[model samples]
Target: MAFQSIKHFALELDGPDDIVYSSGEMVTGVVILELTREIKVRSLRVLGRGVAIAHWLENRSVGVNTVYNDYTSKTIYFRKRQHLIRDNGDLTVIPAGRHEYPFSFQLPEETLVTSFEGKHGSIRYWVKVKLHRPWATVKKIKKEFTVIEPIDINTPSLLAPQAGTKDKMARIWYRNCGQVSITAKIDRKGYTPGEVIPVFAEFDNSTSRSVVPKAYITQTQTFIARGTMKQKRAVVATLCGDIVGPRRRETWHGRAIKIPPVGPSILQCRIIKVEYMLRVCVDVPGTSKLSLELPLVMGTIPLHPFGSRTSSVSSQYSVNMEWLRMAIPEQPEPPPDYSSVVTEEEAAQNSTAVQPEEDLSGVLQPSLLAYIQEFRSRPPPVYSEVDPNPQPITMRRRCMTC
Candidate 1:
């Protein structure tokens, strides 16, 4: 046979999960090879590359025939080439039963954007090995890895609370109808996966019909190429609130919503971007719904304890980031039992809002961890509700001034 000595060629990373490798860190791995006999090797090389590519075809109509136009764009973040083993004067043969060659490379410190993949386009980081020989064909193997640029949630802008107010009017037959208004706020603008977002909202309905209020978190991915753009949006999590009676008002006091497993925002990339939003909306009958949107930044590092941002930087580095990638619960929560519906007597008579308790914790969304292996051992996040402040009901007075 022409080639018989080469038995196995593979790359093995130091960590069990790819999520551990991030920017400004050395990605150390070993190249393993097995052979029955000694073989003369030209060179064994390793290549590390990070790139963002966007490609899609758009259908264009010309006269009667439709033509597909390809829209493609790519941005190269970095490229590194290194030699694991080369044919020097003395080192020519790789003797055999089983051999392991170690390699290490430090990722670029200049803002290496987090890795991401999408349908229209993808931003990826990978390591590949090429084996060259004088008498045999070249052999190659590649493996994708993750690079998470830690976005600390304790920053000034992300730590500040966010609030918004919006109102919409509904009309039937062009006649002037009542209006519905919503005011909503959250504790902060940034959070990692698995953390809870405290939602405080007030809904006032001046219309004749009862209105239902709902809230949901959404993720949006945008890819751009040569003045062309593609976008994908999805709802990540949803929660429903009690209805506001006609001409009545209802308020939500720190009612929290758990964030599902999702990737961090990719704002530094020029070719692609990942973003999130928290939307609170009211369903108005026979008319369009009025909604309020608050921008959110999903991050790798979680918020500081006790809702304080002063020590965020110090605290972020204190925790082991390895556990964060698989920290969240991706399982769908079981349906809640409605048997414990609260009665008027059981509800709080006070309307004042109280401070939310501290939660001691962050997950990789499916898309982010799809390539990473053997990391699903952790249990899902515990579901906790910061009971919303009860709305007090006052009885109507029937005294008439005669």
Candidate 2:
């Protein structure tokens, strides 16, 4: 095929700087093509490219010491070209100085993360222009730019478990051909008070190959109970047994326990129940590493009172429980009394009027006389011997004489 003569080609975009655009925004640009010789073209297309790259690095501090690191890279590309037309159409031949073509592409909305500031990472994108013609070779032009200010998104880490009642337990099962078979179970849903949830982790190496396995376990507990309420508690117990091809089972415990990572390994628990959540992670070390998490619900279920038993078995292993505590919600204190306050009418009716005795100064105060006159006019005072302090006989006689 004959090749087309060298032509002028350039690419430009609309949003090139630190422009903040959402995922659903339209990214637009134009590809200008100037041809020196008249050429018949076929079809043209615009393309948007997105890619993610990841790498890891390792450094050893000293002899027999090792460390590991990781890095990531991402990129995007955009491309578009003009279309040729045949038949009766309003297509004009290029006399070729500078040509302006408009192109547009839609951005994805889901790419925006709402969790972190500037949560959106940079996308190194490029625009490439390609010209295709029969009897002529294709020409190309390229330009590069970046998209910034994406929506902040917070995605929970795979190792981090959510805290709540609805969370579920996670179990992973995998097999290594002719080597070992592994089954791991984690209580991702969370634990109840006095409930001994089991994390059953098993590895079987029945293949002809001799295999050694290493495991790491981490448990976190948070006490959600407070005030006079007892704190939530958790305990993780691990047991390893060897089964050699129909041989009798040999169990290891306490000082007799010996695994690749030699030590007195005991499960760890915290006194304070986490108000938010707590995560327990287990990492198995091997060429193919697998990690899982168990979420412990803090104070959701009541801890059974002391010396209580349940008809439940260990969730991880089939171990019997001697005691179980029930979880209960804390009771609120009673409010204060507001029943003693009386209204104005009730106070007036319940009060008694005082009567004046024998004008001791030989003169009666008009205010006292007026009060006595008002009381007598309304009703006769009901005298009761129950009241030890009674009005004097002189007052009674004065009232009678009046």
Candidate 3:
């Protein structure tokens, strides 16, 4: 038999969760090589590689009337290799037995820390082991791993829950209607996977038209290339909606939207940026829809004191009542008063009739000016209206018999 000695080849990680890792952490694993009998090997090598690749297809106009499909691809990567056994001068022979070679590598400190797999692109990390032979294709084994960075939620701004409400009047479009207002609030603005987001909403449809409010969370990614920027948004999750009666208002409280396992916000990456937002909108037929948006921060860790509670029983409880405060109705601004503002016609008439400055010999006298200046320089007035000035009081008592 040509290849009777080589029995088995495998790779195993030291950690229990072999696929999970953090930046700058040491990764240790073992390469197992089992042989049926004595065998000769040239060398054994291990390599680690991290790469981000983006590829897509689009249609392009070729000539005056012809169109063609084109494909585009871009990649950024890093690779490290180490030799466990090198064939310096002579080949090494091993007796028939189970052999294990341990290897370790330290990931770069300042590197892309999150692993992402998406439809159009991917950020991947893997470790590969190869057994080199003279003139034969090298036998290889590869394993994928996930890398994540710590996103602390203890920051003062992130610790507080986020809520906002907006109201708008549709008089320009819906002239016969009054106003339509939508208020939406979330328990907190920052969250991680496995955490539930509590959403509370209220809608007031003062217009004559019926309104249906819809709310959803959208994840947007911005890709920058060659001085050009492109953006793509995908709906990650959705909340329930309610139909509001015409000229009526309704309130909804404590609707939970679970966050799925998705990549966190990627602000550290230069070419790629990820952001999430909560959008609340009302669909109005034959008119423009009213909508409100709130920025959401997706981190690697959920709010502290409650971590990884997706399977916990207490997560089913309603969020604090404070989250509902965002549903407060919008107050209309006071209408402008024409009396305080001079109109164009009135200004023109006054300008035409106004005379030159009149002589004020009596009012602008030296004595009068001096008196006014003296009065102005004097301290503020002090009145004896309370304790210093006493008022006479009369007291009367009713007898118990009466």
Candidate 4:
């Protein structure tokens, strides 16, 4: 075996485990070095870098031959370098046993994208330490950390309710069958993981074929390279209602779709973007689906306190950023495309609960009276629903560890 003097070379971050760094946050860490003998060092340096990059290859058949083209683009958000040991012409000898070099960096005050690993692109932040010796090879160690740029959901714009309506006409053999229309609304557009999103929607089917009403949370990832762009979408969570007979109507009164653990929306990046959409759809038997999409922004912080919650229910839930560290145990493949087909395994995991109807006619229920007693601490959510003719909807949630 070859001789080596260094026993350990690692970078350790400070703060609580699974702590997510944010903009304008202080990042403190230590570079540890353990050596068995005296080591001569020219200079030791630390570098912090964050960037978004996209690269993909496409094939084109030129007559009988296939040609491959490469597309690449990169945007640097921040770069910082500091010398732990300054060099001055001559080599600096470092007598080694175990050395710990402490370092601190202040993230930029400007907006920074959250840490993400996508299909064709990614936004990443990391700290790298390099050791330079007179005659020995340069030793490099890298450690990646999660950065979740704070987006408060309590802002006026994100707090205002969002609603939309869409209509589609069905056709068969160049003949008009009928029309299907759907209206969907949400209390707000911003939310954090573990919070519940009350989806209020109405579906009307005038068509001859039966239609099923469904709602889902979808994630869209966009990557741009050399002016060319690639996009991938996946359904992260979903809930379904009973079928609406032809020429019938179905309504969703504050249906709950809990936002699963996921990375925040990444919009400040140049080459990559992560966006979410809540879609309420009607599946037509033989034609395209009629869908209504509402934009959604996931955040790192919850709304106001747990008392005055007319829009969000779980105001007690704080930031859950574990997906950042647990998401990518290794390189991640792109999420699957959005599909309505529920396999047996997925159906087995469906949550079907009968929610109690709210006393919207100014009647205070016993549950609210009990909930108001303790304002200091918030209780866990009662997986509930509403309707006089209560139709329990089946919900399927797909969480992105990334």
Candidate 5:
């Protein structure tokens, strides 16, 4: 009779315990076994096992009191079985008590990384020892471990500043680490009207963790439209808003904040050429408030000579004066004079009277007169010329008579 008892079991492995090892690595361990009586073992084996498991739950509620729920689970397993060898070329026997055996097995290199987040799968693995005998029961012992995958980070490139602007600014952030960089563009001099300027924001992530970021940016501009005597100024508007995240639903607040006019001297020039300045400001979490000023120049549409020369040089100034207000006042323009305006029906009738009628008389005159004259002049065949006998002469008879 043969009996076996587990004496000692110890597992030794390198690398992260929760991280799956690359397949090239060797899993080594020792198992000590004792025999109550003299035992004969036909074969001794060791097994290494890896398993991936995932679980999910979903619950939904609708209307006043309706509820729906679901639960799901998935699992995958990998197993390797190897025979344990002894130094000697003979069948090894456990005489009694303490006996130790060392074993090593190779794991598959193509195994996917297991994750505890349940995104990929909950990775679980185990190493086990087993003994096989021809006439005896198999004995087994097992131990378990896990693995984690790495994260990827990315950042954007820096951009140059616009022309004619003073306080040029740039933004950058990390895609994975949530790190942000707000850089002032030293090169951007200013902006011109109708010139689309591109502002860049960059992101970088050098760490192993992934992060999500929310950003808000706004730029305000004030420029003078050169006018004679007094220059008029107003805010040239540009609005932009965007959301950056691992996913799209995140919303960011952004606007070109129009700064209040500092002084009347800022818009004092009078010519087709005008000078102006722009201010840029940004608000973000974990960073100080950012603000900068940039200078710009623009060309304006010249005022009509006679139009600006009207009676009260100041009386005709309402339009130009209103144009000088930078905030873009919300007051509505005066309503149109409806007293002189005609209704749709009346307008349609007036349009009809203004159009000339078709001249069918010239087209029909000659054709009609000719048709009538031809019909009246056609003579009726005379009935008085009727003959009692009709002559019929043969060609041979006519030739003989001649």
Candidate 6:
């Protein structure tokens, strides 16, 4: 109804149905403009850009007085434009017919933050087309694309396994009430989404009260704005309530927690960060929770083949220059905070298989493995509260068909 002269404006990518790309890959697409009637236009252009945005409200209390403050930040990583009709003179008329404009762009080789849609933030790449007319308001169209950076588990740091042990003594005044100790280890520190993380836990509880042990995977996202940093955390997956009776020593040889297809670790990204932690928690009545956390790195690809990887540093200068050319007057914004990077339905299908292994059998006999396996397969424990803060508004993109 807004524009009678235009029929349908469609954008199509030259790839499979899913519009996904890796770092340094070329993105080629076409903008099809079907017009019902002849129209006049000043120029036509296509723009490609990537941006990270974070916005949230913080609450604080001071001496019975409560106050709320709003915080917002945005960062533009790259912005590039290609004019399809730059040289054409003024008042150019596009005849009524099917018209197609082809466009191509190469993503920077430097490691880019993975595409994510979070509760308070987002890292997104999009292609936009504009039909500029002197007699009418500008008509624009936008399409979103996904970008993933390859993560190799075969890297030396990730290849070496990780382990840690901790001991905590509960004290009341000067008297020791109880002591709890745990040893935890993982097969690998780096993993891809859908891989099962086997956590081997040994608990020694020397106390009067019973301790409930729980294991879960946590996702932490840190956003940096200017110099200040804000973080949001969520327990994406979990297994809990395996009782460790008083004065008992229990060993869990195989507790598998599947990694959802979420964004990989984003340490190199300046504004946004995505990191996972395998947590072992023991809840004690009338006492602080005792826990151990181990870092987990997620990537798009696993390092089975151990192929050589290309250097992203080669395009660092070009990326900086591109940012300068965009000339955004405001400060750069940090990446977004994701709420559910992987949907529940999607997560169910992409879980790691609970396969029996001979190597694991050596550590703990079939009895212990079966016990832990049954516990792990049970439904995940319910979380009383994910976060206390108000839910952030979910972002909605303008219709790409418009």
Once superposed on the true structure, which residue ranges of model 4 sit more than 4 Å away at CA?
1-3, 306-402
* Model number with the top lDDT: 1
As for TM-score, the candidate ahead, 2 or 6, is: 6
RMSD of each: 16.0, 38.4, 28.1, 13.3, 44.3, 16.3
Residues 259-279, candidate 6: write the lDDT tens digits. 543446776666666677887
Can you give the TM-score per candidate against the true fold? 0.75, 0.28, 0.66, 0.75, 0.31, 0.71
Taken over the whole model, the C-alpha lDDT of each candidate is 0.66, 0.30, 0.57, 0.65, 0.33, 0.61
Q: Residue by residue across 249-299, what tens digits does model 3's lDDT show?
A: 977666556544445666665555567777777755444556678777766
Q: Please write out the lDDT profile of model 4 over residues 1-402, one tens digit for every residue.
A: 112778888888886434556578778888898888767778988999988787777788999999998989998989988888878777776665999999988888788777776546677888899988876678899887767566777778888788899888777767888888898888888886656677777888888888888777776567788787665555656677788998899877666666555556777788877787888877664466677789998765567675535655223223234532342234222222243432223223332322232211111122222212221122221111211000101111111221
Which pairs of residues collide in model 6?
A: 74-333, 75-333, 118-337, 118-338, 118-339, 119-338, 119-339, 121-336, 121-337, 122-336
lDDT of 2 by residue, 131-237 (tens): 55554565666654433221111112321223211111122345433334444443233332222333344444444333332222222212111111121111122
Query: How would you order the candidates by lDDT, starting with the best?
Result: 1, 4, 6, 3, 5, 2
lDDT of 5 by residue, 105-224 (tens): 776655334222112123456787777665667777776643311111010111123322111122245223333223222223322222222222232222233233212111111111
63-119, model 1: which lDDT tens digit per residue?
A: 999999888998998888888886575447777689998988888878787766565
Worst ten in a row by lDDT for model 4: 386-395
The count of backbone overlaps in candidate 5 is: 25
Root mean square deviation (Cα) for candidate 4: 13.3
Error of 1 at 399 (Å): 71
TM-score between model 3 and native: 0.66
